[model samples]
Target: MLVETVTLQIPEILYQRLVNTARATQRPLEEVILHALQTGSPPEWDDVPEEFQADLAALDKLDENTLWQIANSGKTSAEMERYNTLLEGNSSGTLTEAERLELMALRHEADLFMLKKTQAAVLLRWRGHRVPTP
Candidate 1:
């Protein structure tokens, strides 16, 4: 693919965070930035799974306040406990077939939720919202 170089004056704090991310991930800074630019927002509906289409559509309708709420939400305590239990079972080679499937489904849901939250954060940043750092 053809690529063009462009100059950007990134804020020092954001630049530091990007640099840190690149170092932690063992990726090139340019690659990290490019990936963020490409995937930080909601993807096209056609590119998403059929099961996620409705969720994505709902995300599309979220106001800034609602988006903020979604972006800040974390897994419930019950979800965390279940995840830990599954992890323990897997590590011990004792997970039942049903438990294995449950763990996989839970992981999938967590991944989807994270994707949505990230997209919401990107939207918030685009709208000039002051999102707090972790």
Candidate 2:
């Protein structure tokens, strides 16, 4: 792939830390910085406010909601087709309530995956990883 070079300004301490990390991992400085850039958190905030911070339990809830939104994007017709396919595959009797709920959840997750893909593409462009088309 054709790549473009860009310069970044970071604090001396952070630069030294990156160098140390690269040495420890036996990787180049560029590689270490690139890895950090890819894994870094979204740039919505420099630091989150204490009041807005959600604990692990809240994070679980947020994840569950995100999954539900993704999975339920299919319309009624699509859902029926999915249900029929499942029934066809499982010739070993009726589905339990919990099993049925799980299938619905999976469908919802399928919907969210599309949104996540778009999000990743946008982020990549913002981070200069991918060239954005005009």
Candidate 3:
């Protein structure tokens, strides 16, 4: 594949960390950085589980307006309160079994929400909208 080179002004600490990671993994620095850029958070759906594929397909079907709405969706006030409560409990080492389960459920919900939002953003960009960087 043809490749283009671009210079980046990364922080010294970040650059060191990337170098360390590359050395530890026995991969070239450029390869490591390119891999990270290609497969960012909420990775491509090609190897995702079947259930997630369904969700991705659903998101792909949404119109631009609907995609915009999904992209802007965020956790409700109650959800935020619960998340805060869970964080407090975790910090105090006092999470009950039920609370732990609830926290896990909330985390799963947040992941799904983020996936939908990311997909929506990609769709909007595909439709020629100037989607802002997250």
Q: What lDDT, from 0 to 1, does candidate 3 have?
A: 0.69
lDDT for each residue of candidate 1 in 33-109, tens digit (9 for 90 to 100): 88668656233343567777667555544567788888899988988998999989999999999999999998889
List residue ranges in candidate 2 displaced over 4 A.
41-134
Evaluation by lDDT, superior candidate among 2 and 3: 3
Question: What ranges in model 1 sit over 4 Å off?
Answer: 1-54
User: How high is the CA lDDT of each candidate model?
Assistant: 0.72, 0.50, 0.69
10 residues in a row with least lDDT, candidate 3: 39-48
Candidate 1 vs candidate 3: the TM-score winner is 3
Pick the TM-score winner. Answer: 3
Every candidate's CA RMSD: 13.1, 12.7, 13.6
Look at candidate 1 and tell me the lDDT of residue 92.
Answer: 99
Q: Which predicted model would earn the best lDDT?
A: 1
Position 2, candidate 2: lDDT:
92
- Per-residue lDDT over 16-104 for candidate 3, one digit per residue giving the tens place of the 0 to 100 score: 54564455446687875775577542224545556566686565445567778888888889889989999899889999999899888
- Per-residue lDDT of candidate 2, residues 22-50 (tens digit): 55446688886787688762222113434
Q: How do the candidates rank by lDDT, highest first?
A: 1, 3, 2
List the lowest-lDDT window of 10 residues for candidate 2. Answer: 54-63
What lDDT does candidate 3 reach at residue 7?
87
